[model samples]
Target: METTTATGGVDEPGWDVDPDDEIASVVEALGHQQKRWREAAGLGVAEFATAMGYGEDQVRKVERGARIPRPEYLDRADEVLGANGFISAMKEQMAKARYPKKVRELAKLEERAVELSLYSNHNIHGLLQTEEFAWALLSTWRPALSKSELERAVAARVARQSVFERSPAPELSFVQEEVTLRRPIGDTMVLRRQLERLLEVGQLSNVELQVMPTLRGNHPGTAGLIEVLKFGDGTAIGRSEGAFASRPVSSPRQLRVLELRYGIIRAQALPPGESLAFIEQVLGET
Candidate 1:
C-alpha cells in the first residue's frame, strides 16, 4: 500500500495526553482499541508506522495512550488497517481531548450561555482577542509554556470565538479598560490588528463593546474583572476577581452581585458608538 501523506509529514509531534485529565480515560480506551485492531491485522508498530507515514515512536505513543492522535492519524490508521471507518470515527472525541481541561470546561459553559457579560481590567477578553494578540499575551505567562503547550492554548482560545457564529447568536457585552487597547501586547502591528478586530466584532448586532477610560478611578471594576454568563434556562454562572474568592458561583444571590457590578461597569464606560469611534482613533494613531 502506498503511504498516505495525511499525517502532516513524517513523525510530526503528537499532543501529550495528560494522565490526570478527565478525558484521559477516553483517550486511553481509544488507543487500546487502535492497538487491538493493529494486532488483529497482524501489523507490528514499525509496519504500521510505515503504512501510515508516521514514525515508529509516534505510532507507539498513540497506541499506548501517551499521545493524542490527530484526526489525520486516525484516518490513515483506519485506511491502513482496513477497519473501514471504525477507527476514524473516534476523531470527534480526540478533538476535544486535544484541548486543556480548563479550556474545555469554560468552553462548555460558553456554549450554553445565551448572554455573556464580561469586564477585563488588564487585557482584552479572550473571545474578542485576535489570534496574534492571544499568542503574544499568553507568551507572557510568568511560568512560561512549552512550544506545544503554547500552540494548544492559542488554538483553544481561538476556538472559543466560534460562539459568535452560533445560530441565534448570543448577546455579548464586553467592557475593556483603556489601557488594554493602548498597551501593545505583541508589537504595534499586533495591537493594531487586535483593535481592528474589536471594531469588527463591536459592530455585530448582538455585541456591545465599551471601553472604560483610565481616568475613571475607584470604580466598581477597580477591584478586578467580572464575568457573568446567563443561559436560556434562567440559570446563570458568574465570577469576579474581587468577590467570593474569585470562584465561579451559580447561586442566584452571587450572580446578582456580579451582574450588578458588570452593569455599573458597562454604564460607567463610554457608550458603544463612542467606543467604536475611540477604537478607530486608536487605530489611526497606531
Candidate 2:
C-alpha cells in the first residue's frame, strides 16, 4: 500500500537486485514483495506474522534479509496477496541462478593475480573462508540456494586459497580491520579452524597478514576497505568502496594513488609477526 513512499523515487520502484547477486535474487525479491504487501495492508511485522501463522520475529527477519522463506510459505503468501505466481518465479530464480557477477569476477581474479592484497573492514575476506563458515553464512540469507549453488560457492571459495599453492606463489597480504577479528563468523569451532588455517597460511613464504590495531589511536586504513591487485608485467586492477564499479588502474596516476594508499595502510598496520600475535590475542590463545 505504501510501496511508493517506501521507495520514494517517482521513477524507480525498487532495484532489480541482480538475479545472482550471490545473496540469491529470489530471496531478495521475496523480501521486496513482503515489504510491498505489508505496507499495502497497513500492518506491522508482528501483526502480519500473526495473520500468516508465524512468529513476528520470523517476519521481521525476512523483511530485514536475515533469513529465507520456505517455498510453501511463499506459495501461501502469494495466494493471499493475489500476486499470481510472482514469488513462485522467484523461487525458480533462486534454484537456477549462478553466483553473483561481482563474486564471479573475483573468482577469476584470484586465479589470475600474480599478487593479491586485501583490506577487510567489517568481515573476513571471502578468499580465506572455510567450507563450514561459507555455508553457514550463505544459508542464513533470505532466498535459499540449492545444493549445487552452495557447493559451487564452497569450491570456488576454497579454490581461491590455492593462490598459496602456486610454485612461485602469488605474493599475498591482508590488512584486516580490527573489527573483523571481533566478528565471530560461524561457530566457535568453525572460527577456531579458520584462525588455525590463518596461522598455517601466514607461515607460508609468499603470504603476509597484518591486523590494523583497534587501539592504534590513528590509522590510514580507517578510510575504507581496499583491494589492489597486481598482475604480471605491471598490469593491475582495483576495487574499492566497495566496488564503486571495478575499474582498471592502468594509468600511472591511478596506480600510484592505490599504491600510495596501500603503502600507508600497510605501514600503519602491525607488522606481520605482531599481527599474528594480535590475532592470537583476540582468539584468547595469548
Candidate 3:
C-alpha cells in the first residue's frame, strides 16, 4: 500500500479523503483488523458469532464494514478476540464520523472565515442557535433523525459557535426575520433562551444582529436564507437558498449582485440596537 507521498503527505486511506467523500476507510481498517485478530484466535465466523452471542450474519457484516457496530458490539468483540481495548477504542474515532458530510464541510468553511454575513427568513441562523434550540429544530425536522444522528448534529451545530472565540475575532453579522423570533420552536423557555443568546452575542464588538419586521410587506430576503464568508486571503464565497441550493460562488460579478441584495436587506431591516430592543420586548411578552 502507498504509505506516504513525495510531498511529505500521508498516502494512507484515511489521510486523504475530501470532505465530500465517503469516510469508509477507517471503518474498513477496523473490520480488516477484526478479521485478522479473529483468525489469530482460531475462531471462524460462526464460532465468533456463538462466542459473541450475535448472529453470524451480523458478525460478518461488521467485519466487512457493511454496518457501524454499536459500542457494546465492539466491547464484546474486544473481549472475545482478546485484543484488549484496541477494537473498543475505534468507537471514539467513529463518533467523529457520525456527523453528516455536508455539515462537516460547512463547519470547516466557517472555521476559516474572517468575516461572515447571514440573513435568515425561516429560522435563526445556526451560529446563534443555542443547544436546546438546535436540538428542537433538528430533532423535529421531517424524516426524523436516529438518536445518534440527532446527538451528532446538535453537537456539530453548537461547536460552530467556537468561531466567536477566535483570536482577532471575526466580523459577524446576522439579519433574522421578525417572524422567526415570534414562532417558538421549542416552547417558551427555549425561545427565551435563544433570545437571550442573541442578546449576549449581539453585545460582542465584532458582531451585529438585526431583525426584519414582518410588516415590511416584501423584500429581497423574503425568498430564503443568504450567507457570505470572507477570508483574509482576499477571496470570498456567497450562497443563497432562495435562488438555488446553497452552493459557494466566487465570481466577482455574482458576488457583487449578492452583496447589493444583502446590503439592501440590511438597510430595510431594523438597526442592530433596535433589533435587540425588539427581541427584549418579545422576551418580556413570553
Per lDDT, the best of the predicted structures is: 1
- The digit string of per-residue lDDT tens for model 1 on 60-102 reads 8887788888788889889999999999999867777777998
Candidates sorted by TM-score, best first: 1, 3, 2
Q: TM-score for candidate 1, please give it.
A: 0.88
Order the candidates by lDDT, highest first — what do you get?
A: 1, 3, 2
**Which stretches of candidate 3 lie above 4 Å from their native place?**
1-21, 26-98, 244-246
Error of 3 at 206 (Å): 0.7
TM-score, candidate 2, is 0.60
Please give the CA lDDT of all the candidate structures: 0.88, 0.66, 0.80
- Candidate 3's TM-score: 0.70
Native-vs-model 1 lDDT?
0.88
What's model 2's lDDT at 191? 79
RMSD of 1: 3.8
Q: Report the Cα lDDT for candidate 2.
A: 0.66
- Give per-residue CA lDDT, model 2, range 205-245, as digits (tens): 88899888788656556667788888787778776653335
Model 2 / residue 108 / CA error / Å: 2.7
Q: After superposition, how far is residue 275 of candidate 2 from its true place, in Å?
A: 1.0
